[model samples]
Target: MKIIVDRFISDSESTISHISVDQRFVCFGLEDEFRAIKVLKETRIPAGTYKVALRTRGKHHQQYIERFKDIQHEGMLEVLEVPGFTDILIHCGNTHTDTEGCLLVGTSAHTDPENMSVSSSSIAYRKLYPLVVGAAKNGSLSITLEDNDR
Candidate 1:
C-alpha cells in the first residue's frame, strides 16, 4: 500500500496535512512545527518515503493496546528508518501537543477556542488502523510525506 501525506499548512506550532491512499482521500494529519533548527518533539519528520509495518511488540504497541482495549489489533503502525528519529508511529491524537515527532490521524481538522489546531482523532484512527492492517496483509506498506509548502 502506498500512503501519501500532503502537508499544506506550515505554521510555527504545527503542520496540518491531508492523507490519501492510492489517490483516495483518507484522513487529516497533525504534526509538530517544521523548524530550521529542529527541537525534540517539536519538529516534524522530514518529507520522504518510508517503509511502514505493523509492530506486534514495542512501547507503542503496548501503549495502544492499553489505551484502546476494544480495538482488536495486535500492533501499531510504525514508520521505519526515519533518519534521526525513532519510535515514529502513526497513531491517535487531536493536536500537535499530543504527538512527540509522530503522526496523528484525524477525521477532520479544526481550530479550537484556545487557537490550537485539533482533529477528531480517535474516530479517524479507528477508521485507519484496519485499512493499514488489511493492506499489510498483501505486502509491505510505504508512505510518502510531501511538503506542499515547498
Candidate 2:
C-alpha cells in the first residue's frame, strides 16, 4: 500500500491534510502543528517516507478492538520508523486535540487553520483500516508525507 499525506494547511495549533492510498483519494487528515523545533506532542512528524505495520499491542489497539468491533479490526495501522516519533498510527479522530503527533482520518475536513477539524471520522476509519491492515499483512506498506503550501 502506498499512502500519501498532502499537508496543505498549517496553523499554530493544527495542520489539515488530505490522505490518499495508491493514488486514490481516501480521507481527510488532521495532526498537530508542524514545527521546525519539536515540542513534544505538539509537533507533527516530518515530511518523509515510513513503512506501515500492524501494531497489535498498545492502548490504541485495545480501544480500537472494541470501537471497531463491527469491522475487521486486527491491529492499529501503525506508521513505523518515523524519525523522532513512535506509535504514529493512522486512526480516526476529529481534530488536533484528538491526536498527539498522530494522523487522524475523517470523511470531511474543514480548512479553517484556526480551527481545523475533520468530521465523520469513525465512518472514514472503518473504511480505511481494513485496506491498510490488509496491505501491511500481505507485504510492505509505506507512506509519504509531503507538505503542500497553500
lDDT of 2 at 74: 89
- Per-candidate TM-scores read 0.87, 0.95
Q: What are the per-model C-alpha RMSD values against the true structure?
A: 2.3, 1.2
In candidate 2, how many Å is residue 134 off? 1.2
1-150 in candidate 2: lDDT tens per residue?
799999988888888888898999888889998788888778888899999888899898899899999986888888888778887888888888888888999999887758889999999998777667788987578999999943
TM-score of 1: 0.87
Among all windows of ten consecutive residues in candidate 2, which has the lowest summed lDDT? 130-139
Off by over 4 Å in 1: 66-71, 111-116, 137-139
lDDT of 1 by residue, 1-150 (tens): 888999887666788888998778889988887877778887898999998877787777888887777767768888889888877889888777888989999988774423446467888887777777767555578999999954
Which residue pairs in candidate 1 have backbone atoms (N, alpha carbon, C) closer than 3 angstroms, thus clashing? none
